[model samples]
Target: MSTVSHALTDSATMLRRNLKRMVRYPSMTLQLIGMPIVFLLLFVYVFGGTLGAGLGGVSGGRAEYVNYVTPAIILMTITAAVQGTTISIAMDMTEGIVDRFRTMAIARVSVLTGHVIGSLIQTMLSIAAVIGVALLIGFRPSAGPGDWLALIGVLVMMAFAFIWLSVAFGLASKTVESSSNVGMPLLLLPFLGSGFVPTDSMPTVLRWFAEYQPFTPLIETLRGLLMGTPVGNNAVIAVGWCVVIALGGYLWSKKLFNRESTR
Candidate 1:
């Protein structure tokens, strides 16, 4: 096969194997599914009403509070997928699975690409489910097709960035504990972003952070796509973030793999 064909074939094979492993551990699938759903219900029911009033009632009343928060939370589900990537990669390192792969003829990059692609596919499903629930609860995006497509483009780009981020953790970790260290900040992000509330409601300092954070652009871009509203200047910023992080991660991971192989 041509190099491109070979890479594609290897990536598919790797994805299938990883997915089979995901199936065997049904709980892994459950956590990915259940965790996002639970958060959706909690935020929409418990906090949505109060937060809606605070946003000047975006959906018009306390009853429609669920609509506005849906997109933010849906995008937030990637946190689970990305963090899961880090731990799984870490486990492979700790158990010597990755080291063993080095002795085989398998494509070196496929090992990372497969898991990243798998996680992205899983995250897409979770995002879809969250959207479905949001629609059922009366949320709808007014954004047109092109805008929606742009939203997905940014999301997929963000996924690539995060996958590389996960790979770096995988490369650096000597233990499983060390691998999972990116958790706290990722989980707390929705609270900090326009996820459940607008940036204006936050204190000046936090609003500044929230306004300037890379995630804010991502969330806004997604919000415009889903809600059919304008995302303002977030489009440029979001794409820029994706490019910088993905390139940086690729360069770092390439070097790390070379050293590990030489050892």
Candidate 2:
């Protein structure tokens, strides 16, 4: 058989195995759907009244703060789903699940691809749910068809980037707990960055971190496409980040996985 055909067969078999596992165990489906929606309701209805006083009256403005929060809320879904995938992958590595897989006849890449694709499927479900709620809250996008296509492209790129980073952590972490622990910095970023509020209101020190962090550019670029705001040329930085993180994380993760497999 040709190498390409063999690779395709391996990937398919791996994907099928993961899909069957997910079918029998539906843990992620609920959490990914529930968590972000909870945040959206909590922040919008509970805390939104408070933010409105200074936010061009989010209560009275033509654009509801829900519109703003919706984007952030969508990100919450991405964070929860991706983090879940990361921790799960890390646990598999630490628990010898990956070792067992490595001993199988499947293509090496298929193992990672299968798990990543499973997580991506879960993310897609979460994305749909979030978008539905956003619509219910009047968070309509004025973007054209092209923007919608571009937005989907951005999301896929974002998903792949996180997948590689998660795989890297899975390979590098020595303990299952540590796999999830080090993500605190990543978790703190969106809140401290422009996701929750305008970075302009933050102190100079905080604003610098908020403005320059990777999430800002990503959030802004996504928000531009979703909200029709002028993200402009600044989006180049965001795209660059996707490429850099995916490439770097993937190389390091593959190396770590190779070393661990031999041990």
Q: lDDT (CA) for every model shown?
A: 0.77, 0.77
Pairs clashing in candidate 1?
141-226, 141-227, 142-227, 142-228, 143-228
- Measured against the true structure, the TM-scores of the candidates, in listed sequence, are 0.91, 0.92
State the lDDT at 51 in candidate 1: 70
What is the lDDT, from 0 to 100, of the residue 34 in candidate 2? 88
lDDT of 2 by residue, 43-98 (tens): 77777666644567424432466666676676667767777667777778777777
- Which candidate number has the best TM-score? 2
lDDT at residue 166 of model 2 (Cα atoms): 73
Task: State, as a TM-score between 0 and 1, how close model 2 is to the true structure.
Answer: 0.92
Error of 1 at 222 (Å): 0.8
